[model samples]
Target: MKSHIYITRHGESQWNVECKVQGITDTPLTSKGIEQAHELAKKIKESGIKIDEILHSPLSRAADTAKIIAEENGLPLTLEPRLVEQNFGEYEGHEWKKYPGVFHEAKKQFACDYNGGESMLRLGQRIYNLLDELKVRSEKENKTFLLVTHGGIARMIHSYFNSETNEEFSSTNTGNCEIKEYVF
Candidate 1:
């Protein structure tokens, strides 16, 4: 049986609007974010996509988006910690523009850790594990599901599906509630 997976990043948060880094710290969605989510719900409903189950990162932002979708679709929500954002370590709450060399540093051959946070490779492994779990679950249930996660997590998923080439797979500009369809 074939199954479809819809992946999306959470809506904008206060930190996002403030132009601050939000790796591990939890932040509430902005009013505009709530509105965007509502709009997203309407679009998904109108698209006639069949969603059987919903999974989400346990982070407040991602989980909140999943809750909204689940509430609207009358489905159960599963929290998957593996879907959480990359641990930014010491870079957790800094302003992106102010963080010198952050972009270049991330792409180094030997990925750096954010002191007290996880390394990119570590995060990638976690994401891979989560996808494996989802694949098994999808095969067993023979159903479509949605995963609500962070931009970083979304990038990891995209990279995985795209075969993890050296090409950059950045999701920094992914819009809130933007849905990506994956079929297998």
Candidate 2:
């Protein structure tokens, strides 16, 4: 049987507005980010989607967003370490534009470890492992899940299930607070 999964990227962080790299760096959400989380909760409620639980990244931005959504929807929230963002290593907190080649290289080589950071392939594996666990749990419990994660992880998850090529996966991106649903 297929399970319904709701996935969302965390709301905008301070680093996001500053256009800085935030991989594995803890940053709080802006006021607009809080609003976005509330909006997402409202949207889910209005749409009558039933969420059994919320699994969120441990980062502050994602945790805060998950808190709001879980509270609003009366779902239990659990922090899933595997859902954390890709570690950008030395690039964390730096301007993204300054290391254009790093991004390009990462995209080209899914196994490339960025400046001593985590590789795209490793990130994908963790996310897939979480998904596999969730799939089994959802099947046993007959429940749906809401996953709150970072943009990089979100894109990786999307690519893991949807993309047929590295180029296709690299081209995919998720906007802050954007929601994507899948039946798996």
Candidate 3:
């Protein structure tokens, strides 16, 4: 049987609410984010989605979100660095929306590359590898899983499952604990 997988971006962090770029630097979730996660747990229960295992990025925000979901669903959670967000390099602490270069960079969509950091191509490959491992486990062991990761990583995951189309597939602003499901 094909496995059903769920991918989620971590709840809103202090940095996220502040409109700062939170690349590799870890941040804690806001109070609203905790509430969001709780709501997500309720949604999962209502939907009756059975998560066999949970995987998270090493980042605290992602890890905490995964932990909450796994606890609510009684599933085990593991950390996977490959699922971490793309490193922003020089742009790490800068407010991209306010910073001229960052603002300009955002408009380019897929053509833009992060300054002195991982390229989109590389980010895609990392997520692809994580999914490949998940695919093997699901196919061979018949397990379903959830992955908690960063926004950039989540975008890559969405792109992978949706296929590399010219048009970007953006997730609705998934608040803390929001669940985005994919069955394959």
Candidate 3 error regions (>4 Å): 100-113, 166-175
CA lDDT of each candidate? 0.79, 0.86, 0.76
Residue 95 lDDT in model 3? Answer: 82
TM-score of 2: 0.93
Write the number of the candidate with greater TM-score, choosing between 1 and 3: 1
lDDT per residue, candidate 3, 1-184, as tens digits?
Answer: 6677888888889898888877898889988877777777677778988878888999888888877887887878888889888887666777856775543345235445666777677777788888888888888988888888877777777776776444344332344555688866
**Candidate achieving higher lDDT, 1 or 2:** 2
lDDT of 1 by residue, 1-184 (tens): 7667889889889999988878879999988888777777788888898888888998888888888888877778888877889887777787877876575456343367866778778888998887877788888977788999888788777776776544355423466889998865
TM-score of each: 0.90, 0.93, 0.86
Cα error, residue 119 of model 3, in Å, equals: 0.9
Q: Lowest summed-lDDT stretch of 10 residues in model 3?
A: 165-174
Model 2 C-alpha lDDT per residue in residues 34-124, reported as the tens digit of each score: 9999999889889998889999999999999999999988889999988889997766787777766566455667777777999887887
| Best-matching candidate per lDDT | 2
